[model samples]
Target: MIVVGVDGLRPGVLAVEWAAREAVVRAVPLRLVNVVPAWCLHDGPTGAVADIGAWMRNGGKSALAEAAAAARRVVGTVAVETSLLGGDPRRELIEVSEDADLLVVGDSGMGALRGLLVGSVALGVAGHAHCDVVVVRASAAGPRPEVVVGVDGSAAQTAVLDFAFREAAVRDAELRAVTAWNWRDPLGGPEASERALAEALAGRREIFPDVRVRTEVVEGSPVDVLRHAAAQAGLLVVGSRGRGVLAGMVLGSVSQALLHVAPCPLVVVRGR
Candidate 1:
């Protein structure tokens, strides 16, 4: 099943949008997770604590019902479920992700209590989730019809590219494969970038020729370039840096940028 974390009263509209779409594509059910405070778990479920627990559950049910209603608006007829857990949203969401096929959350300018669902909580889940995670930053400029993916000449990218192509095919949208062009090196300029991107796309054509692919070589940091491309696309795909860290070249930086500032849904693939 596809799972999404909602902020309850405030909610994350873009997250619901992605969860609905992804559930439709995967032919799976959608699960919404709402995490409240941990006061009752520590204080025990008795007396005044029991009253508070009921209140928390009521609020959680209300919030989850709102999120489920919003999801229904998108996919029309799909199975949607919800769970209300106590404790920190960040830790609780990581646990919720254990059984999820894809985890979807919102980008809520985290760092404060009000933004718990999308901020630090969302980022932590995306970075550490065993399953694939999608962070949604609502698109303000109407509907974007295409999907953009950042592809560098790095290991495991073929797997990530395959993930992007599959989503593009599911959306029946145009796929743009973007790479940061290095102009300082004369040997690996635009021509080099073109070749690398072509090689990356080579064998995949036979598998997903129906996916209209557009390759680009932009002269800038991968984070900046991919952000620009994602601003106009419906979704942005990138591979996690795994363990290593690279400044502007690796997706570690790109993922950081897009996780907070992207205009569309961002998918960070952890595996092929």
Candidate 2:
């Protein structure tokens, strides 16, 4: 099933809509989840504390109902479910991700402080979730027909390619496979970048014959190149780790950078 976090904000609403369409394309159930802080559930010495707890719960329920309605409006036949969870949003979402095929969350939060970039919960879940995490953002323009993916010549490229190709096929969009090489590095050039991309994509085209792929090898930072390409893409996909990332790192610098700057929804395909 596909799971999405709901917070009664525009980004959250958009996330639900995106997840609903994805559910229809994948023929899976869509689960809408709303998380309440664990502290909100406790009854303090003051009676007002209990009232505040009740208020939070009511708000959560309302948000879930609205999200569910929005999702149904996207596709009436889609199987949509709602869950009201309590605890830390990051922890709850990571646990939920264990059972979900995909986990989606809004790029930002409700208020000014949280609205700056990606919310803390979204970033945390993206780093630790058991399944692929998609940080959904509001598309600035109309429907985009291209899906961009960053191939870093890492072992995780397999998962990145698989996810990118599947997403492109499901959306009936073109897949643009991009590889970037830093110009300042003596060992790196266009030829090396092309060779890495070719090696990674070898024979994978046969698995996704219907997907139309355009490979690009550019000289620049991976994050910079991928961010530029994502301007015209509906979705930007990347692996959690890249060739330059250390084995102990959970989320690579490139993936984290794009999560904040990608103009489209960013999918971090974690190695399983």
The candidate maximizing lDDT is 2
lDDT of 1: 0.77
- Which stretches of candidate 1 lie above 4 Å from their native place? 9-11, 41-53, 109-118, 184-187, 242-251
lDDT of each: 0.77, 0.86
Clashing pairs in 1: 110-119
Residue-level error in angstroms, candidate 1, position 147: 1.0
> How many residue pairs clash in model 1?
1
Angstrom error at residue 210, model 2? 1.7
TM-score against truth, every candidate: 0.87, 0.94
Mind sharing the TM-score for model 1?
Answer: 0.87
- Across 38-82, the per-residue lDDT of candidate 1 in tens digits comes to 774455678877898878778877878888999899888879998
lDDT of 2 at 112: 19
Clashes of each: 1, 0
Question: Poorest 10 consecutive residues of model 1 by lDDT?
Answer: 109-118
Clashing pairs in 2: none
Positional deviation of 216 in candidate 1, in angstroms? 0.3
Candidate 2: where is the Cα deviation over 4 Å?
42-46, 109-112, 184-187
Best by TM-score: 2
